[model samples]
Target: MTTARDTILARLGSPDGDPAAEHAALRRDYLHEHHPDVDLVELFAERLADYQAVVHLVPEGELPRALSRALWEGGYVIPDGVPEEWVSGIEPSRRAGADTDLTAVAGVITGCAAAIAETGTIVLDHGPGQGRRALTLVPDHHLVVVTADRISADVPGALALLDATRPLTFVSGPSATSDIELSRVEGVHGPRTLEVFLT
Candidate 1:
């Protein structure tokens, strides 16, 4: 009997073949065939919003102010780590980073590691520069900032750039669930609202 590893290897075709070249060619063919006219970022935004996520576009220089305004409008108390420059126009109460309870927060604004356009997914790895995972997960609303350069065309391309060792969260849209009756409900497991800001 063939071992599982041997079976998998056989199923993947001959080992003598250039795996990288074969995979690249396959990806190219698949994308051209199925996603010929896709404007990756636009498609991603459309899908995200279709899933009830609010999408916003802002200039790079205006990012901080936009974030502050979004937070204020969403009724969140600002945390200290959030730059004062960003919160300049907003009138929300300010608290130290340690003082803010995530559950009580109406929204949390964060920078994403990257976004995969084909699947309309945003990736978050809790790196020190990116902020804590709890900040994004515990809040009712998540406002993610994704620069144009950080957007990828599809899952395969996105995965190629991601670090496998890190704890990663992939979000396609808002948290949702379906009841036994087949009724669909939103905001069950995570953020009820997922807002994406593309710069």
Candidate 2:
């Protein structure tokens, strides 16, 4: 009556072989990232842009101007933890609850935990400057501000920087999918536009 999974468990639980010993027998090291010779910032930007997302590299103090120019349409909203100075010229409507109507806002700007150079993925642990999951999902546009030093070399490095206990959202680009007939549809499930500012 024992299933294959049960048999495997029995062997794994045997006195001779502990899980740690089994793990020790396997190769534990591999290349973490490729082309380490290249600049990490450039790699991260290229990966991010490859996903159909626009990546902006701005000067240290120019985030406010860059954000304003990118979010020129106005009506932008932000999470509570987002710094007020980031949106200097625009009035940002605040949203505290998860059910807020995000589509009404022209864009939603937040901060990311880490950016992956290999995958062009941005990780959000719903931490400070990052609101609930709905904030990024419901809004038509997502504008994320990240620092250049926050870029990780690869997915594993990014994973190491994240807190698994928190809600994590990995966004590579705007929400999009191709239909069966080969037509591409955007914003079907999440934000249609993704903007990243690497300062």
lDDT of each: 0.72, 0.81
Candidate 1 pairs with clashing backbones: none
> Best-fitting candidate, measured by TM-score?
2
Which candidate tops lDDT?
A: 2
Return the TM-score for each candidate structure: 0.73, 0.83
lDDT of each residue in 87-178, candidate 2, tens digit only: 67454343323445666666688998888888888899988888888888887889999887778888878887888889899898889999
Tell me the tens digit of each residue's lDDT in model 1 across 1-199: 8899998887677969987777766534445224657777787788788788889878767877777666634355343344455446555453325347777667766667778887789998766334676776677878777878878787767776688789898988998889899898887778888878888
Residue-pair clashes per candidate? 0, 0
Query: How big is the positional error of residue 95 in model 2, measured in Å on the Cα after superposition?
Result: 9.3
Instruction: Kindly report which residue stretches of model 2 are placed more than 4 angstroms away from their true locations once superposed.
Output: 1-7, 10-27, 72-74, 92-100
RMSD of 2: 3.7
Candidate RMSDs in order: 4.9, 3.7
